[model samples]
Target: MVRNHSEDRTESIILPDGKIDLFLFLDDGVNFEIFIGGICNKPIVKHPFPKSVMFAISFYPMAAEYVFKRSFSDFLNKKIILPPGYMGFYREDMQNFEGFYRKACVTMQRIVTDPIDTRKVKLFDLINRSKGETKVEAIASEIGWSSREINRYFRKWLGITLKTYIDIIKFCNSLKQVKSGHFYPELSYADQSHFIRTVKKFSGTRPTVLGKNENDRFIQLTTLSDD
Candidate 1:
């Protein structure tokens, strides 16, 4: 959860790691709104209300299929407002973040009752095990599939090609290092220049600027916590 303390300001959402998010926004006037957000490959800006509280659940790339019963590509780079009565089944106090999280977990457990997709599970496991360093060809070879076939599966289920997903995972891993004050040269990128350029591309700001922003810190916290 996040609470903004200043005047309404535009926040840049950097989701270099692919995800689908569910958000609940509670403004100062005590009105609540909920939205389902899809995969984002680039930075997006939104103005949030002052003193607003937001609770969000970031879903794994593969979980979208089980949770929503739709192809992940269908909601790519999109946000859809849920119906007004969507939260009626839960009776938790909205002000309690932990309570809200418990309610969300219960709801998700009920919705995700379908059998697991073993292929997708193995793919996700392989990518994570390699720490985003494995090449697409290597992954495909290990999985006994052609590169083209692997890419097709990724696009059909995750709304992005395999290469893009790998890039996002690498970028997010490097971002965590940057946030931890371990911005050493030759650590993740080729050099300092390459690091700065990649960070700017994914976050819409250079490393220095991103590190100094309070809102960005919160964003990083949320991203890291999801992992």
Candidate 2:
């Protein structure tokens, strides 16, 4: 029998973006995403547990070494992103996940073109190296993309800025730990407060309030902001 225990599910959906992500796989940092297409049903990215179940057709492991110095957006939103821009190609069909992951992979790979940039190829490896310590300058320098271009690629791919995406990753990880009774809690409930504040600041809710509580559902943070 398979013993089951809940752990952090590495995933997030950014508000107003056409991407939903399944983070932390294929490598420690790089994961997958399903693009939101009004005309296309993209793939559903998958994580380990309580996650939407989907079969992943693995891209060739050798594909991981591909590096890219340019951004993914040269063709992405411009409607020029080729299907082979990213993955090495595998077709996964899963009725359970409604084909979310497969469609996303196909869509992402659609952006590929000849002479793939070695810098962009490194994005996958960089994600693995990030480990919560990645800095904007470093990311910008490594792939030879400017900070602005990198932000555009991140915004296009992950549906959020790199820093924001990282925050969401950290928050969701801590959340999983808390739910599984593995989180370190301060006697003063400092974790809860910080979690709530951070969520409220970014997600516009208390941390424990999301997903599990209907009331936790909230309007986007920008609507509540003082800008």
Indicate which candidate wins on TM-score.
Answer: 1
After superposition, candidate 2 runs with Cα above 4 Å error: 1-115, 155-159, 182-195, 201-204, 209-227
Any idea what lDDT model 2 has?
A: 0.39
Cα lDDT computed for each candidate against the true fold: 0.72, 0.39
Task: Give TM per candidate.
Answer: 0.84, 0.40
How many clashes show up per model?
0, 31
lDDT of 1 by residue, 17-57 (tens): 67788788877747778787887777766655787777788
- Model 2 agreement with the true structure over 98-151: per-residue lDDT tens digits: 454556557556644456656666854675445334667777788788889867
The residue-level lDDT of candidate 1 at 127 comes to 82
Task: Spell out the clash pairs found in candidate 1.
Answer: none
Query: Ten residues in a row with the worst lDDT in model 1?
Result: 84-93
Candidate 2 lDDT trough over 10 residues, lowest sum: 35-44
